[model samples]
Target: MTSPSQILLVFPVGECGGAESVFMAIARHLDRSRFEPAAWFLRTGPLVEEVRTLGVNVFLHPITRLSDPVNFWRTVKAGRRLIIDAHIRLVLSSLGYGHLYGGIAAHQAGVDAVWWQHGIASPMNLIDQLAVSIPAKMIITSSRVAARAHVEVFGMNGIRLEVIHPGVEIAPDHPDRVASRQVVLDELGIQPGKVVIAAISRLQPGKGQDIFIRSASSALRRYPQVMFLLVGSEMFGMDRGYELRLKRLAVDLGIEDKIVFTGFRRDVPRLLEAIDIFVHPATAPESFGLSVVEAMAAGKPVIVTDVGGPRETVIDGQTGLIVQPNNEQQLSEAIETLLANAQLREQLGRSARDYAGAHFSQRTMIEKVEAALHSVLEADTATKAQRHEEGR
Candidate 1:
């Protein structure tokens, strides 16, 4: 029997974020029979262990300060050696640093390098852009918006760009959803008949949690039964006093009683089920809204900023309402509209679920990734044959 192709997946951070989550999914769901998967991470954390549980090998290589000439050449030499020693037939990098360090190693080792750019957060510095121009087999973008950014800004070919929208899974029980809602509400001391409005993302400035709170303050004046949920925490527990800032704002707004901050809960699926409405009001352009899709999968009506990948995910009048990004008044009005019309909410919720299931499923993402791998492999084979013919 032929051995499976060993593929090295390089992602610097071994932590859960939007990009990391998608990388984890790819490692977990890759066609195991044909591909042997392993990962390289800079540091170990929750995400590293999670990948290990998926039966993928994880290696730690602290790649530091590549801008300095000595560090750059030393790391590149080490990366090249690592790829060769591991017998890595295909090399894939997620995020900026990984693309620079990992792609360098793969290029020198005579292997095809694939780059996955999930969002704008992984800004391409001089080193990163140098790596991109240097010879990549494929550049996988997570959204259409990202694909355009790469082409217009970085001058990449559309033919080489592969866009795979992010995906999430839905829990399969309605009764359990009701029970979960009750459990969460009880824990929060929220009374029955309170409408839950949740903004589910890391407590960061760009995520627009502050925007949500400001909108919720206005929303509370009109709808007193509303309860706002802020459902995430910053990485490394380094919130940069953002949480304190939010609390202070909440107190000043006089809607402190209406808000609930559940910092980093493992029960996201349960919370999504319990939440009445999902709001993703990103102050900046969101590459793709994973939380928004997860909420839609839970059969909740969503209101997302109309500026980025989130806009593409939702059909404004059908799946969810699209309001301008960073506009508190527009956001509040959208939320209030959902609150007042039960029939509209239900209709949008159902449509959102159907759209999410069909368009953004784990299976759909896995299949697209599988196809990309085969394309790269086939292209490599054809290129080698062409070289042999030219020599003759």
Candidate 2:
């Protein structure tokens, strides 16, 4: 029997952000009988240890800055050596640094490369230009909106772009709903019977936590029993003082007592169980809205902005409600509508749970990703054979 092909996965960050979580899911669930996966982290953090616990080989080579000439080439050399030594058949990378460095290493090592595109494509930077110029076999995006954004910005050139929505693990029962809600209420010193509404994302300006707070203020006027949660922490100093600003905004809106900021949670699934309603109000176009799908997997009715990937996942009044981005009144109205109608909430939650289970389960995502990877390898092999035949 032929041995499983060795595939090297590259990540620019070793922190468990949404993109890193997607990478970990891939590593944890990939089919070992068909492919053996290893990882190289460009920056070392908690995620390196998390991946190690999964029993996948993890290599940490801290890259200070990719812009530095010496730093760039040295890391490329190290990556090339690792790929060659591991007999890597294909390189799959995440984020920009991963694409640029991993693509170079795979090119040098005579292997095909693919990258996960985790952001909405914007104006091309120098790094973006360089990364896009690499001869990667595929560029995998998590949503059709994201894929279209890339085409609008870069025009794809000749690269193959595949849309693979992010997924969550679906459970047979919501066993923790009551227990998790009690735990959160006790932890936050809130009394019982209050409805929990939450927005889960890092405290970034683009994440629109302030908008959530503003809407929460409006919702509180109608439903005094509603409690709001902002769950997640800032990362990489990108949103310095952003959390403080959000807190101040909540205070200014006179809803500080009604909101809880659970910074940097590791227990998102449990939190989702505690949540009665989930909200994602990103000011910018989100790439995939992993948290929105996660809430759906938890059987929670969600309210998301009609800006990006979340709009595509929800059927607007069927699966969940979709509101205009940054519109505090619309968001508040949606929240009030759900809170007023328990039957509607239950119906939407059931539909969302069914939709998420059928289309966005981890098993489904892994199957799609595995097929795409195999197709890339097959196409590369066919191209090589054609080149050899022509040369002969």
**Candidate with best TM-score:** 2
Best by lDDT: 2
Q: For candidate 2, lDDT tens digit of each residue in 1-392?
A: 87878889998987778898888999999999988899999988888999999999998888877668898889999999999999899999997668999999999999999989888887755666678888788999989999998899889788899999988899888555687678967887778888899999988988888889999999898898899999998986576889999999988888888999999989898788777899999888888899999999888999999889998899999999999998999999999999999999999999999999998999988888899988988898899999999999
Provide the overall lDDT of each model, using Cα atoms, as 2-decimal numbers.
0.84, 0.89
Off by over 4 Å in 1: 64-75, 121-131, 157-159, 236-239, 389-392
Candidate RMSDs in Å, in order, are 2.3, 1.5
- The TM-score between candidate 2 and the true structure equals 0.96
| lDDT string, candidate 1, 1-392, tens digits | 87788888887776677778788888988888888889887656788888988988888766555557777677678778878998988888886667887887888999988988776533445655666666688988878987787777777554488898878875465656677788978988888778899998888888888989999999888898889999988875556899889999999999888899998877788788778899998987777888889889888999999767897799999999999988999999999999999899889999999999999998898899888987897798799999999999
Tell me the spans in candidate 2 whose CA falls farther than 4 Å from its real position.
124-126, 174-176, 387-392
